[model samples]
Target: MSQQLILVLNCGSSSLKGAVLDNASGDVLLSCLGEKLGLPDAYITFKFNGEKNKVQLSSNPNHTGAVEALMEELKKHGFDSSIAAIGHRVVSGGETYSESILIDEAVIAGIEKCIPLAPLHNPANLLGIRAAQEIFKGLPNVAVFDTAFHQTMPEHAYMYAVPQELYKQHGLRRYGFHGTSYRYVADEAARFLGKDKNSLRMVIAHLGNGASISAIAEGVSKDTSMGLTPLEGLVMGTRSGDIDPAVFGFLADNAGLSVSEATDLLNKKSGLLGLSGLSSDCRAIEEGALEGHPGAKLALEVFVYRLAKYVGSMAVAAGGLDVLAFTGGIGENSDIIRSKVLDYVSFLGFTEDKEANTKARFGNAGVITTADSKAIAVVIPTNEELMIAQDTARLSGL
Candidate 1:
């Protein structure tokens, strides 16, 4: 096969995350696009294929603008401009896709049409693809949906008790997110454990700013936390995890708040920040709580409680976990979360080597579980971008 360059674009509701990777060597030729468009002082950073030199470009460019700027910068940075294809991290696939797909005008429209299903994210994801189509004209584009892997979810798991008409007309249903992250970590965890991906019954906690746990059976997503939107899952940086649907009605009737207002409050001002009244960062919360900050202490407790509950729930979903894996910012880096989560699952066969967990630096991935434990726990740093690049390369025949 000829050398192929695959670029992955990850667009958030308000910002851009992207990378250009070499397929054969598994090297990142470019690793930037963090520009928060319309927000000055925002910057883009890159660690170019192991070069000691790191590059930064400042100016908070939003998703669309940032994507174009990155394309321009690629040539200027002396990158090989012949990209074989582009891969996009689309958040919702609705019922349209069961796997990674080569992008077409019709496919793009289908993805865009699902915006209502993932109002907060799919649109921004669409923006990135729209920009890529215009900037990288003639190049093949692939969309690897965050909900794609979960499409394997059984109907009973994804179906709501709501009227069938609502789903048929508005696509109202559970479409789990963070699939790319789970997929990468699951495969890597199996490789690290010297087991085949399809052979393990593992519980994967993709804890980060947005957190979710997946029950992986035979290498496919059997169950996941995030549903419809990221807010439906485990407690996260700013989004409320699972909540009673009646709360919306109660608040609307008595609190004088509209549904939209309530939604914003939950998605942007809740979670760790709401609970702590401090920063949303777990590190800050852990440090503050340890020092006797009341709100922080409560916040940390709640966070851990929610995580423990879900981890245990997923263990049941997987029919009991043989291995438990943690990935994402908090999952891979927060020793405190690891300790707390493991402690909660001790009854369900989780083991932890405190010294090993605290010292592990996670990019290359390793086992954080102890030798004597029945259930092996690991910290596998996620690389959704690499997975996207690989998928795009495969689909594009590069």
Candidate 2:
């Protein structure tokens, strides 16, 4: 097959990550990260041909500036001419999109319409899309939404207990995130297990700084931890996941905080950081726990307990878990976390291969359960960028 190059862009509020990949071979030719965008000390880091380099960007760089810098890097590496299209990682498509689609005026409007649902992410994603359109004029742009895969969820799985009119009017229901990661891992899990994708029932735990779990039955997302936004599910590095709604009113009355402040606190100040009163990084929390720090131990326990609880729920939602797969940063690297989670869910017939779990880190992917276990457990590193590139190539007819 001939090479089909697709430039994948994942833009955050103040950062842009770009990768040029051969869609046919799934090999990344070049990758770059523009950090601290719109700040005075903005800079960009690039990795290509096994070499790493960093360069300072203009003062107060914006998304367009970052895209231009990426373009320059692409040109420098002679990859600019071979680019076929650009794929954007959009965080929310609401109920409007069920799959990846080419970006157009109508799509942009649809994205804008979902701004209230993903207030922080959709705008940043739109910025990246517009910047890429400007920098790479006429290149087909395809949007791969993080909520699209969960669109297959049944009505009962997505609807809230609130009045039906609210959901009908505002679309206030569960729309899971990390779908791109889930999509990648579900296929990988099937391949690793040597089973047909549609025949497997898998529960995927995407544990990272921003964590979530997904239940895939017959190769389709049935239920996921994250809801309307990414803040609804598993305890993240800083997010206080699955908190009671009353906490907002209680904090307002007792702590004299507004709804906005309470939301910010939950999304930014809680989770491992709040529980441990230390760092948000899990590695640090694990270290502190090892050192017998009470707060860190509590944080670790709560995190693991919540994670295991979700795993159990996802297992049920998937009907039966034939393969319990772990992905994302923490899922792939943290044997301690994985082992703890498995121990909690041992009732589900998952027996951890301690040796195997420890070995499946740092880009390694393999089964981490005993051969005789009823259900298989595997650690598969997620590659969302490659998924995006493939979708872009197929959708754009590259």
Candidate 3:
């Protein structure tokens, strides 16, 4: 038997989140988060066996340093040496994948081909891969893509009404992100609802720094919020969700700004933080709103409004919704946000349990819907790392 440990490397533009798991038991042996690497500020932390700890990396760290740091901690802080595999989270599949697959040079090249579509994400993901290859040189590492689940979305839903030539020439269509998380939660929802995995329809809301809603029908992704890019999705931490294209030309004509500059403003300066001046984080806005901050109130309201509208539309797109789930930092932790989302859909058989909701269950999956409610409301903490580990195991035959 192969005593393999699969490590998940999730490298974002400015940070890294990784976890090493024991494939036999699905236990997370080690998880590390390196923040601000390659940026002005940087710090590294390691969560050993899912415990909060100060697993430190050296000063002036970058992506490579972050990977090295985690390996050192594993050696020092007690992890089995049977780690035989690594799993990487690659964001954009760009029609190259419909499922998680084994990683090789060709897979790496395929990911690189998707860089233009995901300029900000794919390169960082590749960095994590390279870092693992350097540190764990002999191990088999697999890649689990975030766009793989949405491959089931029909072209009518995934395609944009733009010139077919651009899409035909550039492979430019809606390649959604968060497929791993959505798939993870959707499966859990089916289990929680006691529905057969292949026949259930669920709407999963993954709300966090980057948020998206997916409508999964008969265990396949039918529609999702994010489009061609993350910027097109629901209003994100800093990215403006959806905007009128005509505004770009108008801003250029009236404000004398370039397309790139306008694009930057929408992606970096506009969203909850821009609308709420108090903070980009949902918790901060909720607190600020309680303290009578106008910007905070506006931000909170807009965020919830965006969520409710999308949930309704997703239900319509799915033909109907059997279950509605919440996951991610804000979705699982924030009761206020959950309440707001539920309130908008009361007419659709969603009713909340105040007592159960008040007791926030971080990382636990359960129904928060009222006993009599037809459409269930659930809080399912996402486990992207576990999904990565599972994929890695399947590919490595461990």
- TM-score winner: 2
| Residue 53 displacement (Å), model 1 | 11
Candidate 2 residue-wise lDDT, 286-323, digit = tens? 99999999989999999999999999999889998899
RMSD of each: 2.7, 1.2, 2.2
Q: Write the per-residue lDDT of candidate 1 for residues 1-398, one digit (tens) a residue.
A: 23577888888765677787888876777777465455655555555656533233354345555665676677776554667799999988898988999999899899978888888788888888888888888889999999999998888778889999988898888889889999998889999889988878999999888888999988888888888778887988888899998989998999988999999989999999999999888889999999999989988888889888988888777777898898998888888888988898899777789888888655646677789888899889898989998999999988
Per-prediction TM-score: 0.92, 0.98, 0.94
Span of 10 residues, lowest total lDDT, candidate 2: 1-10
Model 3 residue 174 CA deviation (Å) reads 0.7
**Local accuracy by lDDT, each model:** 0.83, 0.93, 0.86
Question: Candidate 1 regions off by >4 Å?
Answer: 1-3, 38-65, 362-364
Clashing pairs in 1: 36-60, 36-61, 37-60, 37-61, 37-62
Q: Which scores greater on TM-score, model 2 or model 3?
A: 2
Better of 1 and 2 by TM-score: 2
Alpha-carbon deviation at 90 in model 1, angstroms: 0.6
The true-versus-predicted C-alpha distance at residue 339 of model 3, in Å, is 1.4
The local distance difference test score of model 2 is 0.93
For model 1, the run of ten residues with the poorest summed lDDT: 52-61
Candidates in descending TM-score order = 2, 3, 1
